[model samples]
Target: MPVREMKIDDLPQVLQIQKALAFQDWNERQFIAEITANYALCVVYVAAALHTPILGYAIFHLMGPDSELLSIATNDSHQRAGIGTALLNAGIAHLDFENGDKIFLEVREGNTKARRFYEKHGFEPYAERKKYYADGENAILYVKAT
Candidate 1:
């Protein structure tokens, strides 16, 4: 897999992946804004073979010494193949290299798999937001010191 900065042309494939996943999906404009933002870091993981699909993407924002992982997702077909992990590790390393002091993200309270994945990467639960999702699910904030 080759992880690289997301390009404008990649939005359609990215949107398809987002639509297939059961999560808070961002609209095309939102993705465009993030990709163009001065403080944002957006990356995509592309499959190695010719004409292969994009496997995953990660979008984060860095402000001062704090970084927030806004979204990350792997295509359903590519899940559990380390694509998400690679994107996350690459994002964290990018943040650290940029002198970030801490990184934050929020996962749905019921997403045990995501929570466990963050925990495995040394993120600790810092807070919770009630009814953070449109579906009335709470959001668990997780933070990792860089």
Candidate 2:
């Protein structure tokens, strides 16, 4: 249950977790970009076993006082095991909250489980973006303030 900064060499296992999840479509190139971005916070939840090195991943971008949680997910086989929570808590702790930073994230309108998860972590739903996704589902925006 150790969370650490994501490394390029971990992409294969990370991609496998991403492919098993439904929300994120980010490819290897995108992950590489994030890992290299100065303002991006990308982390992975890892296991000791070599066969399943990564169990979850979280990506965030920080801009001055605003931070955005771009994506976070746990492998299907690892779901309900607190990996997601560990990833999210680590990401939030990285944000510059002392300066009154606020974190933002969006969830698909129909994703009740995700909404609940965010809410449980103290994110409050504030707004909605219509037809935000290609599938035309509204995006519910949630925010957490320092």
Candidate 3:
């Protein structure tokens, strides 16, 4: 798992991974906003042997002591291969360095795999928002201390 701070040049590959696995479809503009935002920490997991193509990415927004895991996804071909976990660990390390107190995230109810993954990683689900998604899917909100 070779991880690094996401650079602007990585958006094309990141966007491709996002398109294949993201819960919320984010355009290039949104990705740019995160890359340029001072409060956001975006990290990418690259395959060193494959010319460093992005295998996954994680976006974390740090607001003082509070933070949010905005999005995280691994390319479909690389799913369940620890790419997601590597991205998550990288994001958590960055958040810790920034003195973040907690990390929050919301996952679609139907995304059981994601929900399970979060829970497995120590995130505790505290609430659920009905019809939180545009598709009327409920979103389970979870939080974990950094």
Q: Which candidate is the best by TM-score?
A: 2
Give the per-residue Cα lDDT of candidate 3 at 28: 93
Candidate 3 residue pairs in clash (backbone atoms < 3 Å) = none
Estimate, for each residue in 1-146, the C-alpha lDDT of model 1 and write its tens digit.
Answer: 48899989999999988999867668999999999999999999998684656889999997768789989999888788898899998887777644338889999999987888789889999999999988899999999886
* By lDDT: ranked, best first: 2, 1, 3
lDDT of 2 at 3: 95
What is the TM-score of each predicted model, taking all chains together? 0.92, 0.95, 0.92
Clashing pairs in 2: none
lDDT of 1 at 75: 89
TM-score of model number 1: 0.92
Error at 80, model 2, angstroms: 1.5
Question: Against the unseen true structure, what C-alpha lDDT does each candidate score?
Answer: 0.87, 0.89, 0.86
**Which is the leading candidate under lDDT?**
2
**By the lDDT metric, which is better: model 2 or model 3?**
2
List candidate 3 stretches off by more than 4 Å. 97-100
The per-candidate count of clashes, in order, stands at 0, 0, 0
